[model samples]
Target: MVKVILFDLDGTLLPMDTDAFINTYLSKLAPSVAEIVDPDRFVKALLTGTEAMIRSKDREKTNEQVFEEAFLPLIELKKEAIWPALDHFYDNVFPTFSYLSKPSPLSRKIVEEAGNQGYRLAVATNPLFPRTAIHHRLQWADVADIPFDLVTVYEESTYTKPHAEYYMEICSRLDVRPEDCIMVGNDIQEDMVASEIGMKTFLVEGYVIDRGEPHYRIDDRGTLEALFRKLQRKEGIFAEK
Candidate 1:
């Protein structure tokens, strides 16, 4: 009964060394906003804003709103003075980070297979970035063309991963029960937390991040090929549900 399949982008669909990607991303991002704000303060504000998004629990405000509320106050420049720089960075500079993420042909295949089988697809990446940045990363994975029912961007999401509300919100938007969705990701703590509200979970191997014991048993292994084959055989994680 898995009507929706939620895939995490960074480590799951797009293979990456998380730390290397972040370090390189920040190194590039810092200079892009340097003319408007000091590089040091820019990084600090960016990190602070990200933390605010992560810790956000306000159901009424989008993550972007929460991030701006927490971020703008700390810096001297107003949002109007700095937003264009940030937009320019995402449009022009962010694509350079594509080299940090590996392309996955299987990602597009699995998403296509899911869509063919009548399952709704979503990019359930943690919503810390703008849609443009997420879209660019999806392109790097070669799955950007696949029609995803939902892509969790900061402007749309109210919570970040590891919070059950995040999953709940997605389910609500999709009009599907938690038990009828499956979450596939490499991070045990962030992705598998979908199980807190009854979604089935899969743990991808290569970039797996296990923090302590996982909250729920992983329902299946996480290669797109394996998942696709299992679905073909009617033996997918929720096959019996």
Candidate 2:
């Protein structure tokens, strides 16, 4: 049975320019801590913190911990200062970045329909951000009722997508096999990699990058809506095969 459907955020669910979000986020974050650490060093520390979390091997620790562990030593700031900056970043800067996102009414409708149909939906967004940040962004898309039974955040996941273990972890947690789930996302390399592990895949072409013109691309949410409805009507996703 196809018990779960995992969706990526940012480009996939939220529909935003990733670079714009980062540039806006850093601009807000930099000035707040400029006095505490060298301006250039602060930026370097922040990037390092992000990278460390990406490269983390300790699955038990949350991403925030990994970021702090990597970042704290470089800045020489009190441990307490980090949270405040994070708060400022999300509070003041994050909302503005939503402007970069192009809203899709059909996207919300599809996700809601999937939840109503009893699919185990999850916002399988990369776990680099804290849950709070992710939660707020989802709200911006007007996607309520966190449809996912399990949400994968960078902190909670030891491996990021493109790594088969990343997809396997969610499948294991949801008690489903790789072939029983579909991963939908805008990035070809990051999201389509799920196919390498035997899961079904969909590419949302509104944001697709040619990058060699990968196969299995769908042009818009209307196509995705059609697919979601078909899956909903199926008795068992793999039964036809």
Top lDDT: which candidate number?
Answer: 1
Candidate 2 residue-wise lDDT at 158: 67
In candidate 1, list every pair of residues with a backbone clash. Answer: none
- Candidate 2 positional error at 238, Å: 9.2
Candidate 2 stretches with Cα past 4 Å from truth are 209-241
Task: TM-score each candidate.
Answer: 0.96, 0.84
Best by TM-score: 1
- In model 2, residue pairs whose N, Cα or C atoms come closer than 3 Å (at least 3 residues apart or on different chains), thus clashing, are 63-155, 121-148, 122-148, 127-153, 127-154
Model 2 lowest lDDT segment of ten: 213-222
Superposed model 1: Cα runs more than 4 Å off: 238-241
Q: Candidate 1 residues 70-151, lDDT tens each?
A: 8898887789999998899899999988888877788787778778888899999999999999999999999888878999
